[model samples]
Target: MIRVLVVDDDPLVCAHLEAVFGFADDIEVVGEAYDGAAALESVLRHRPDVVLLDLRMPGIDGLAAIPRIRAVDPPPAIVALTTFDSDHHIVRALHAGASGFLLKTTPPRELIALVRVAADGHTVLSPTVSRRLIETAADRHVTRGETLARLAALTPRETDIVACLGGGMSNARIAARIHLSEGTVKNHISQILAKLHCTNRTQAGLLAQRAGLRPPRPAG
Candidate 1:
C-alpha cells in the first residue's frame, strides 16, 4: 500500500482528501496535520510514502516544512498543495525537494494518480505548470549557460532522459519513447539524479527546462 499523509489547515480539506484516498485500494491515509510543525511530527510518526501538503498554514507553512520533512532519513515524497497554479511558493517548494505541486482544485481521480506518480519516483507537473515553472526560472535569471554547465556532467543518453523528464514523462512513457526497458529507464533516472545533485525528479526536470532541453522528436 502507498501510505499518504494529508496536511492542511482546513479540516474540511483534510477530510475531503482522506475520503478521496479511501476509494483507492492501493493508497492509505496514514495521518493528517494542520500545520508545518505537526506535519514534521506526523511524517516521523507515520513514515508515509507520500505527503499532500498545503502551502499556506497558520505557522511553519508548507514552504518551511518541506525541507525539514525531506531531511528525515528515507524521506517520503512530498506533493505541495496550492489553490493557484501560479503560486510562487510552488517553485520554492520544488527547489526545497518536493516531488511536485498539485492545485487544490484537481479532480479526485487525478489527485490519486499524481500521488501514485510521485510514489513511483517520477515528477507530477502538469504541462501548463511546467511551462510556468520554466518561465519563472528564466525570469529569475537561471540562464541556459549556467544550467548547461550543470547538464554537461551528464552523458548524451542521460541528457535525453533529462529532456524526457523535463517534459514530465513517467518512467514507462520515457522507456517507450527512448526504446529502452522500464528498468533501464529507472536506473538511468537514478544516475541522472545523482550526477545532477538533484534530490528528486522534479528538480532534475526543472534544471532540464532551465537548460532549454526537449525530448527528441519521434523518428520517421
Candidate 2:
C-alpha cells in the first residue's frame, strides 16, 4: 500500500483528501497535519510514502518545509496541494524537491492517481499547471533555436521522448503514442537521461522545457 500523509492547515481539506483516499484500495491515509510545523513532526512519526502538502500555512509553510522533509533518510514524495496554479510558487516547489504540483480543485480520482504516480517515483502536475510551465518557458528571452542547440547530444528519437516527458507522459502512455513497446520507451528514457546527465525523469523534463520543447497535450 502507498502510505500518505495529508498536510493542510484547513481541516476540511485534510478530511476531504482522506475521504478521497478511501476510494483507492492501494492508498492509505496514514496521518494528517494542520500546518507545516506539525507536518514535520508527523513525517518523523509516520514516514509515509507520500505527502499531500498545502503551500500556504500558518507557520513554516509548505515552501519552507520542503527541504526539511526531503532531508529525511527515506524522504516521502511530496505533492503540493494548493489552490494556486500558474504561479512562480509552483516552480519553486518543484525545484525545492516536490514530486508534484497539484491544484486543490483537482478531481478526486485524478488526485488519487497522482498520488499513485508519486509513489511510483514519477513527477505529477495538474494539467493546467503543466500548461503554465510550458507557457512560462516559452515566454523566456531565450530563442527556441538557441534552446534546442543545447540538446545536440540527443538523437531525434530521444528528443521526441524528452518532449513527451515534458508533457508528463508516463512510459506506458508514451509507448502507445509512439507505437513502441513500453520497454522500448523505458530504454529510450534511460538513454536520454544518460546523454543529458540527468538523474531522473523530472530533471529530463526540466531540460526539455529549457530546450523549448512542450508536449502536444497538457499533462493528464
Best by TM-score: 1
- Give stretches of model 1 more than 4 Å off: 126-130, 133-139
Model 2 misplacement above 4 A:
128-130, 135-164, 172-200, 213-220
Q: Candidate 2: give the clashing pairs.
A: none
Over the full model, what C-alpha lDDT does candidate 2 score relative to the true structure?
0.82
Q: What TM-score does candidate 2 reach?
A: 0.74
Per-residue lDDT of 41 in model 1: 98
Q: What's the residue-level lDDT of 131 in candidate 1?
A: 62
> What lDDT would candidate 1 get against the real structure?
0.87
Tell me the lDDT of model 1 at 149: 97
Tens digit per residue, CA lDDT, model 2, 55-142: 9998799999988898887888888889988557766787677888899999998888888989987888886675657346332565
The TM-scores, one per candidate, come to: 0.90, 0.74
Give the whole-model CA lDDT for all candidates, comma-separated: 0.87, 0.82
